[model samples]
Target: MATIDLTSDAFEKTVTADGIVMVDFWAEWCGPCKAFGPVYEAASEKNPDITFAKIDTEAQQEIAGALEIRSIPTLMIFRDGIQLFSQPGALPGHALDDLIDQVKAIDMDEVRAEIAKQTDEPSDAD
Candidate 1:
């Protein structure tokens, strides 16, 4: 239930885990990132079922670059190995909680069908 620091090696396995994973991409020098830290931590304790991880942008340059984290506080949510949400900014505790609720309520079966449809669609290059 405690928030874990994520390194490049831990990133993949953490996100690809079987359940909800919330990752906060942040840096110590960032004001917003600092402000959001406690809020994120509080949520982590409340939502024990979700894996809460933080990636320090300064230390984990490779992982930050790979993810194209242009901002200090980027929030990403992964469920069942599918990245359902990615947003750049700090979220208030209430808003973050609301988002978690929304993500949990998603119809993954429809989402999977939509992904399949998009993948199966022919390209326009022809």
Candidate 2:
């Protein structure tokens, strides 16, 4: 699948939907970002089921600021609207592929159970 360009308008829908999303925060001029572009694009093509988005830090400064993107080429992975992992810097294609594999390997049922446990608190009176 093709990568969608992220902006203030599309950011919410793209990141918050139910499924896996991988967002790359980058700038055109950043050398490392440029180097990682092809790898990111290839990954998106390989994983059509996962939503892949790229936010140009220069064009979408507000979004960048909101996400606290301190460095170029920051990759954040979200599953079911919740952030699962985040990292900064340029990574090789293999490393990124491995990361994706690891994320996919997560047992979502366990995660949901954990969330339910945390939120299922007893009343204070008890």
Q: Candidates' lDDT values, in order?
A: 0.93, 0.91
Pick out the ten consecutive residues of candidate 1 with the lowest summed lDDT: 1-10
lDDT of 1 at 124: 83
lDDT (10s digit) by residue, model 1, range 47-109:
998999999999999998998889879999999889999999999999999999998899888
The TM-score obtained by model 1 is 0.95
Which candidate has the highest lDDT of all? 1
Query: In model 2, which runs have C-alpha deviations exceeding 4 angstroms?
Result: 118-126
- State the displacement of the C-alpha of residue 45, model 2, in Å, after optimal TM-score superposition: 1.2
Q: All candidates' TM-scores?
A: 0.95, 0.88
**How does model 1 fare in lDDT?**
0.93
Cα distance off (Å), candidate 2, residue 104: 1.1
lDDT of 2 by residue, 34-102 (tens): 999999999999999899999999999999998899998999999888789889999999999999999
